[model samples]
Target: MSKVQAPELKKYMDKLLFVNLQGHRKVSGYLRGFDIFLNLVLDEAREEGTADKVECGTVVIRGNSVTSMELLAAR
Candidate 1:
């Protein structure tokens, strides 16, 4: 029998992410990991029925600053 290996996940490990904390100063940080963090944040908001209050944007993080901001337009 032959064995198959799944494709390795690419390193977006250091990519910067800017999260606007709802009018609070924007936060810039190394996105070492995010999927789990995002889910947790969302889940908590859902339980409190406050998820609708959150707004999110994706920004390319460079060092400790945001490099660009763009809304995802439909194709």
Candidate 2:
């Protein structure tokens, strides 16, 4: 299936990203891929909440749930 992500977002492919989702969930992952719907395919993904950080490997996130996204600087 061919999913097209925004041209702007394409720049961040294969880089670390900080993604904010609905319900106050924050995700940090390496952007492996994305689609037209803004759905994201992340590697070594980690989600953070008020309580703690949860590790999620090779995750595909639905576009509709994404609230905001930023490319994180590499250290």
Q: Compared with the true structure, what per-residue lDDT tens digits does model 1 show for residues 1-75?
A: 976543231243444433444333444333444332232111111111233333343333222332332222211
Tell me the whole-model lDDT of each prediction, alpha carbons only. 0.31, 0.86
Compare the candidates by lDDT and give the number of the best one: 2
Q: In terms of TM-score, how similar is model 1 to the real structure?
A: 0.29
When summed lDDT is taken over every stretch of 10 residues in candidate 1, the lowest stretch is 39-48
| Candidate 2 lDDT over residue span 1-75, tens digit each | 987446467678788999999988899999988877888998999997788989999899999999999889642
Q: TM-score for all predictions?
A: 0.29, 0.82
Clashing pairs in 1: none
Q: Give the RMSD in angstroms, all C-alphas superposed, for model 2.
A: 3.7
lDDT of 1: 0.31
lDDT of 1 at 9: 19
